[model samples]
Target chain A: MKTLVIISHPNILESSSQQFLIKAIPHHFDVTVHHLENEYPDWNINVAKEQKLLSEHDRIIFQFPFYWYSSPALLKHWQDMVYTEDFAFHARGKALRGKEFGLVLSVGINEAEYQAGGREMFSISELTRPFQATAEKLGMTYLKPFSIFQFGYMTDEQRFQLAIHYQQVLTREKDNSLEAKEKWIMEQLTNMDKASLSTDDKIVLENAVESLKNNRHTIDELKLILEQMW
Target chain B: MKTLVIISHPNILESSSQQFLIKAIPHHFDVTVHHLENEYPDWNINVAKEQKLLSEHDRIIFQFPFYWYSSPALLKHWQDMVYTEDFAFHARGKALRGKEFGLVLSVGINEAEYQAGGREMFSISELTRPFQATAEKLGMTYLKPFSIFQFGYMTDEQRFQLAIHYQQVLTREKDNSLEAKEKWIMEQLTNMDKASLSTDDKIVLENAVESLKNNRHTIDELKLILEQMW
Candidate 1:
């Protein structure tokens, strides 16, 4: 699916997580990264341009660093302006109906701080109800939010895993099944540029792909059996 | 108690509810009405000035029309910028600690549209969780939010009642008990401009005040009994 990641940070250059996520867009997935602060320095969001962008994408993500338990001022202003009543909540037709909506949040504090008995005293889900309501009103499918807490504390391996997980959130077929995961991983592997890899690395990659193909075949047979039983 | 009702409306002149609220401050209460849009036409809030105002008030009410299930963008930005770490959440002591925080919301939609099986699908309390969490974090008391729904649909009697109820929300002593309500009503009645009223109206007002004084005395006697029993 084509995805649009709208980044709403006051200072994009200073945010490491924003850079990482922008660079982590899956190679084979059609993605557009629009940074709000960079696009509208004067805080005048062009509604027509934004509406056109929303029309072209099936999955839209609002990516931002959480400020005071919500998005920054510009993003809030953008929502207030661009999502006009006639365009978003029309009686005959909503412009964004049937589109997928999601939030990619980068919080400065640790994840543990956002729970009962924690310092924040509210789950991220509870704090983000407004966005969920907005999606429901517009007849959009709201995806489970992807939150990265304390990105500065992440190790290299963790960062790598986070990138892959982020890509899965963006490109998956709205399923979390092992079959679906394998399908996505297999696609990524098959689309890899092997020209830059060493001979040993290419061999390893080929073995991995072969193993995935066998697993995919076995899963298909199991599904067929289950279908027959039903 | 001193109150700082920070009004955050883009067009204050256009909002009848806002204007009604501005004229609803109690007679004997110390209230400073600061309209953010009027004060900061450039949208740049003076942190030092806001900090000073916050410091001086025992009650801080964020009065605004609900925009997308939260305050307008400027209010969000005000919270973000004015409530800085060194000032609001400092290690030494929070500046606004022990103060009461409340929300005076004016929703354009009907009240019934914000409950289970309704179009909004969330109560005001649930949707305004961020403000509660913020108050908790800063060691302030989060008062029950006061909402005026579809103010334009209200009758003149309803509007007058709203003004009184709005005053009670702003000036009540953080309780909803009958005794507390009586005490507040007594205060307002005692402080009224009786000189402007007709002689018959004056007599009626005096009798009401006399009845309230007796009720207050009786409540005190009951409290004494309960205290002695305890």
Candidate 2:
């Protein structure tokens, strides 16, 4: 399924978090990054063009930095102007039905600060109810949001892992079972460009693939035994 | 304390709810109704002017229809541009500290639908956490929001009562005691122009003022007795 990531920021050029996210998305993945502020300088959005874009993608993501505990103003403006009654929610407006909606947020606050007694005094999930309600009203599947907290402190290796996790969220189906993850890993290995790998790199890749297959076989056997007993 | 009601609607001329709110605000009350769209048609907000307006008011209310489970884009834009980090928050900025912040929202859906197992499946309080978080971060007192649900279904009498409730939220202190309410009633009666009333109207107004004072006395006595017993 194709994914559309609608990115919005007041100043994109200076934002390292936004830049990292854009660079992290795999080139081969079927994802489109639509920069909102760059596209509509005057806030005059084309409804037909936006609706057509929505219709083409199976999954839609709103990606932005958390400003004032919510998204930047332009993204909210986009929702107000594009998702009208006749096109998004009325009797003849089930155009967004069965589509998947999610958020990719970059929070400047610490993760521990979002809690009952913490500085923020609420969870990120609690704060994002408005987006969930919007998705529910439009008959879309609401996916768990992906949040990056305190981007200034992350190491390079962690950022690379975040990118891989982000790619899975965009491309893979919404399943967290061990069997599904193993299947996804096998598919990724199959899709790798082996011809471009050096001899040493190819040997390491083959060994990793063999180890993953052995783990999957053991996991399936254990699952079969447990299911039979139950 | 003075109050400022910043009203925002895409088309204010056509909204009966907005009109009713503006008309219902007591003329003698120390309140200013600032229409956001009319004030900034070009979207270029004057930061100094807005901060000055905010500093003058004790109670700051955002009055608008609940669009997409939140305020319209203009309100969010106002927040982003006007509420600068150096002016509203940070080490030296405490301009809004200890002031009251609240929302007056007109919801299109039914009240009963906002609950578990209901159509909306979430209360209004649960949905407005973002606003609450904003108020907390700014060191402002967050008041319980005043929501007008299903305006098209409200009767004239209900609307009038709603106006009274709205007025109480704006002008009164953050106290819900019966004695406080009775005191407010007496104050409103005192503020009335008794000279403009006919003989019968004057007698009725006099009786209401007397009754409210008597109730306040009775409430104080009861509270004293309960305190002694406990």
Candidate 3:
């Protein structure tokens, strides 16, 4: 899939987490990393260029560090400028229709803090409703956000795992059916034997494949039973 | 109450609604209408000046047109810059603690468009949770946001009424108890008799006073009954 990762950090060069993630993005997928602050230092967004980029991509990921429970000003400015009525919503046709929207946030605080009774007093899901609304308005599928909290305190191993997880999230097919998703995972695991996998990694993959096979079998049996009843 | 209305419109001079609202702010309250875009044309936020303004005010009102389901980029910029750790949340003494934070949004779309099944697909309250979370973090009271939607479609009479309502919202005393608020309203009405009041206005004020008196009586009775039961 053609993925456009719009990174909106005011001082991205200073951020180690962002640098690490950018480097970790897999080479296979056609990805464009458009840094907003770098492109528009004066906050003057090129609307036509942004719209063209959006048209060229299937999945759009907004990657940013959460500033004061929201994104940096540049992202919002980009939205205000790029997602105009003629381009995004009330265009000649719906420009972003069938596109997928996703958010990848690196927050300063710990994940535990962003809960109902916690210090932050709201979940990441609740805080990112504006993005969901925008996606909904433009007829795009809003995916569940990928949030990395307290990145400054993360160990190297933890950061590596997070990058791998982020890449998986970005490249994953937008398959709605559980059966299809299970099949896809199984297929991926089956092909991974060629890769120089560790013994522990092989065992984990085998276990996942086995669990998914069982699930698929159960789902097939249920479908057969429903057909028979009908 | 000392109210500092931080108006963060990109182009406030062009907006009739904002102009009308700004003109309507009563002279009685110590109101500071800070035009953010005008003050910071280059987006270089004066952090110390903003912190000083916050310290000077009892209530800080974020007055802006809602852009992409939130305030404009400049407002977010202001938040990121001015609301620093040492100023807003983690100073020797909490600067924003015990103060009030309020939002006044001028939206282009109608109010109905921001409901569950509407085009926007989220209520204003749900979307503005970031500000609420900010307030929670800073130990400030997050007041109910005042939203004026579809200003272009509003009649002159409706616009006039909105300005009056806006003024009332800004200047209203932060009284915790119902009795104190009722007393304040009664006092205001008593003083309003000296002004050249229309018959309908006089009748409305009288009815409001009567209703408040009845409400106070009922509340007093309930308190007495609760005290006796205890």
Candidate 4:
């Protein structure tokens, strides 16, 4: 499926995770990456160009590091301008209907910090409701988000793994077959026996699952690929 | 009690409800009405000016029409800018603590559109969780939000009444001794008892309660003042 990733980072060049993701985007996949801040530095979003881009793609991903628990200033400006009345919304018909929307989010806080009793005091899901509501209002299908937590302390290996996982989620088929993808993830992880693994082991297993799907290779093959990645 | 009404409407001059509110601000209330869009048309918020303004007041009112279930774009920009680290939060000497934070929100949807099965599919309070969360984080006391509903359909008389009510709420104190405000509202609109009123009505009653506590004016005397407001 054709995918359009709208990167909304204020400064991608200064970001390790964003740059890693940018490097890992496979040229083989039908993908187009649009850097919103680079394109509209002054916050003047071109509504017609944005609407046309949306019409041309089946899957759209909003990639950004969560700032103050939301997207950056440029993305918010894009939402206000490009999603205006009589264009994205009250148009001839619902122009954005049936398009798929997903978020690729990175947060400085760890996973534990996003729970109910966490220091940040709100879950990533709760903080992301505004975007979910936007997708709902625009009649687009909202997918489960891809989150890279505690990005401030990520090791080089962890960053590489995250990029591989992002590539998997981004280039997935847009047809109604994500349940198959979920089952594929379950089978790839070490053993389906969930009670034995520690939290860190589970994350490794999950990332392995994602990488296997993207490369269409087995977990053993993924280990071999990672061994040769450098 | 001193109050700071920070107006965040994009175009206050073109707004009927907001324009009326700005004009009716009482001279004796130590009120300062700020037009956010006019001040920061280029989206460059003066952080020191904003912090100084917050320091000079006991209550900080965010006055704006509800846009996408929250404040407009410029107001969100203000929040992202002025409510920064070392100022609104995490500062050794924080400025926002113990201050009152309230919203004067005007929504286009009617009361019935915000119930469990309403067209909006969420309660007004639920939609406003972000603001509440912001207040909680900044160590500010969140007063009940003042809302004017069904703006697209209200008659001229109703709009005038709304403006009068808006002025009353903006000037209300943060204490609990304003019981007569509730009683007077029930007298004005005898269609329903006070217990069954909507969220918008609750704000007006609370404002009246606040006004009574601060001004020490009888309900009849306040009525006479509003009657001669023109």
Candidate 5:
């Protein structure tokens, strides 16, 4: 899929985390990285240009450092200027409809801090409801957010691993429906068996397939019980 | 209570809803209306001055028209710049501790659209979780948000009534604690009986007092049940 990452960080040049992630994006994929501050230094967003960019992308990722539990000002400003009713939400202007929308956040604190009993007092998912709501209003599929917490504390090796994970997340095509996901898993198992592999690795793959089959059976049983109750 | 309303609308001069709400602020309270866009036209936030303003207020209100399911970009920028860990969150620099924090939002859509089954697919409370989480981190009281929806659809009379309601919400000293609120209600009833002479008004006040008493009784009964179970 054609992906566009709109990065909104006030001091992107100074941010090591963002720089690291930017370099990690796979060169093979058709991806455009649009830096909001760099593009509009004076805060003047060209609506037509932004809408044109949106039209070209199948997946739109809003990437930012989580500032005060949300994205920085420029992203909000971009939304205010670019997403006018005539371009984003009007019946005739549903340009973003059926496109995938996601957030890529780098949080300063530890991941554990964003929980019920934690200092931040709410999960990242709960705090990001605004983004989800926006996607819902625009008729876009809201993808699960990609979060990297405590970037400052991560070692070089850990940072490299995270960057690779991020690239996979951005480029991978996610089939969210249950049936589609199940079919994909089955195809993966079949491919694993056909491919020449070491005995140990083949055993691991077989165990994983067995576990998935058991999980599917359990889910089906639960569904049957729910249907009976209804 | 001393109240500081930080209004962050990029184009406040053109918004009638914001102008009306501004005019309705009660004259009795010590209230400062800080227009962020006008103050920081260059987007250069004076951190010390902003911190000083926050320190002086007992209640800090972030007032804005909801843009992209959140506050305007300038507001987020202000937060990113002004709310440094050394000033807002550090153990030794807990400037916002025990203070009240609230959001005053003017959403373009109807209020009903912000529910689970509605087009918006999330409640206002859910969307505003970031602000609530910020308050929690700062050890500040997170007041229930004051939202005005569909401002463009309201008639002159409706607007006037809403303005009055807005004034009450902004100026009112809300004791969020159940015990404190109950105590305040009882005191109001006592004061009403002593000052009022009209029989109809007196009857209305009496009914309110009776309802409050019943509510208190029910709460006490529930507490007793919980204690017994424990």
Candidate 6:
């Protein structure tokens, strides 16, 4: 499936994490990357072109640094403008129906900061409900979001490794069969030692994880794996 | 207490609901109204100025139309730019600490569509988790949001009546006591028959309804009640 990555950072060139992730996306992958800030510096989006691109891609990825728990202004503006009535909704679910939506986010805050009693007061999954709702409305599949936390504190070695891992996750083929994917994710979380894997490695494992049988795993087992991964 | 109203519609001039509400806001209220679109015509925010306004206000109200389950692009931009570190969350405690944050919103979709098992797949409260998280991080009290749904179908008569009610809610004075405000809200909701209120009206009521307990009624509410005395 053709994947479209809409990169939205106010200053992509200055972004170490975002830039690294962009370069790590597999060169051989059938993916197109569009930078919103660069493409529409004036904020006058080419609505027709954007709609055409959406029509062409089976999967859509929004790549950005999490600012104020959401995306940059241009992406919001793009949604407001490009996702016009006929194209995104109304008159027909003709364009976006059956498509998949993905979010690739990087945050300066630590992972522990996002929790029930944590400093941020909500989990990352909780914070992304709007996107999930949007995907539901458009009849698109809301894939699990990929988040890279503590970007500001990462060492050079960690950044490089994360970049490599991110590319792997973005390029990894999704098992469209829900049963197969579910089984795959369960096995990875149950048997595999997550500490050995990078963020991207965890994603690859997760993408294949859906096929694992529920009886084979327990909540504690999965939690231990996730703890090690973090 | 000083109040700040951040109006974030892309074009409030064209909006009958917002315009009516804006007009109804008393000119002499102890409030500063910031029209985001007017301030950031080029979409380039003055972060310093915004931070100053936020610092000056005891309560901050974000008023907007709900787009894609959240505020418009300008609101996102304001949150990202204005609520920066050192000002909002950096110094042990910050300017936003102890302040109150509330949302006043209108959604195009119907209320029934926002139920868990409904077409929208999530309740409005759930959908606004990101904003809640933001307020939590900034050490602000996140008041329950006010929302108006199915805005496209409101008749002129309904809107006119809503305008008077909207003014009461927006300009209500906040007392020093939280318990008193909470109790007052329950009374107002009972007296006003909340079920009869539109989404827009509910939001204003939820935000400004506190002052009633202190006998600090808004200009609009005072006028209506005093008119009966005449």
User: Over the stretch B187-207, how does candidate 2's per-residue lDDT look in tens digits?
Assistant: 778997677889999988888
How does each model score on TM-score? 0.95, 0.96, 0.83, 0.74, 0.76, 0.74
Q: What DockQ, between 0 and 1, does each candidate earn?
A: 0.80, 0.86, 0.71, 0.23, 0.60, 0.58
Sorting all predicted structures by DockQ, with the top scorer first, yields: 2, 1, 3, 5, 6, 4
RMSD of each: 1.9, 1.8, 5.3, 12.0, 9.1, 11.6
Task: Look at candidate 2 and give me any clashing residue pairs.
Answer: none
Report the first chain's TM-score for all candidates.
0.94, 0.94, 0.79, 0.74, 0.76, 0.73
Binned by DockQ into CAPRI classes (incorrect, acceptable, medium, high), candidate 2 is high
Per-residue alpha-carbon lDDT of candidate 4 for residues B105-135, written as tens digits (9 for 90 to 100): 8887787877666666666666676777778
Candidate 3 lDDT at A54 equals 95
DockQ score for model 2? 0.86
Instruction: Give candidate 6 regions above 4 Å deviation.
Output: A152-165, A176-230, B155-161, B173-230
Using DockQ as the measure, name the better of candidate 4 and candidate 6. 6
- Give the alpha-carbon lDDT of every model: 0.90, 0.91, 0.86, 0.77, 0.85, 0.79
Error of 5 at B167 (Å): 2.7
lDDT of 1 at A197: 100
Model 4 residue runs over 4 Å out of place are A174-179, A182-230, B91-93, B175-230
Evaluate model 5: give its lDDT: 0.85
How many steric clashes does model 5 contain? Answer: 0
lDDT of 4 at B111: 79
- Identify the CAPRI category of the predicted complex in candidate 3: medium
Displacement of residue B21 (Cα, Å) in model 2 is 0.5
What is the per-residue lDDT of model 6 for residues B5-93, given as tens digits with 9 covering 90 to 100?
89998778899768766776655566788999998898788888888788888988999999988889988887887777778887753
DockQ, cand. 5: 0.60
Task: Estimate the lDDT of model 2.
Answer: 0.91
| lDDT, candidate 4, A171-216, per-residue tens | 6554446555655345435435667789998898788777756665
- Residue range A116-223, candidate 1, lDDT tens digits: 999999999999999999899899999999999999999999999999999988888898788788888988898877889999999999999998889888988999
- Of the candidates shown, which would achieve the greatest DockQ relative to the real structure? 2
In model 4, which residue pairs have backbone atoms overlapping below 3 Å? none
